[model samples]
Target: MDYFIIVITSAAGLYFHWWLYVRIKRWMDRDLALSLAGADADKRALMLQRLGEAQASGIKRGDLPAWLARAAGEYAPPRD
Candidate 1:
């Protein structure tokens, strides 16, 4: 039916959109992580240490990204 075709097309569109979004997100995150990790040795060590502390303190795997983001924000320099 025509309606079935429309529904299938819409679903495919949504799936492709989501797939693209995830791909772009992953690439951007990798770029940002490399930039931050390569910026300063002391800061990088501190970030790793703090992340270890967080893991030791029982932060779950699913929550680590948000936790790391918050920790990074704390250490990030203020922008003008």
Candidate 2:
């Protein structure tokens, strides 16, 4: 009985963590994409080239930009 309770709670915790990760990752992607869209053409092109090289070197696509942005500074959460 104790084992069953423990397993259930553990599963719940894992699910919550996964859900939270997905939400935050999605937000980061959207934020970075919007920022890039607003950037001037030359700057945007340079950034995209860097992102492509990073992807070729084994970094996952669509992630480097957001990671770089976050490392640079924290962003405000999107309003609902």
| Top candidate by lDDT | 1
Encode model 2's per-residue lDDT on 19-78: one tens digit a residue: 999999756654564475455555445445544555467666456776545533433333
- TM-score per candidate, chains pooled: 0.48, 0.49
lDDT of each residue in 1-80, candidate 1, tens digit only: 99999999999999999999989965654454445566776666666776677658987657767776777767764366
Q: Could you give me the TM-score of model 1 versus the true structure?
A: 0.48
Stretches off by above 4 angstroms in model 2 are 39-59, 62-80
Model 2 global lDDT (CA atoms, 0 to 1): 0.61
Clashes of 1: 0
> Model 1 scores what on Cα lDDT?
0.70
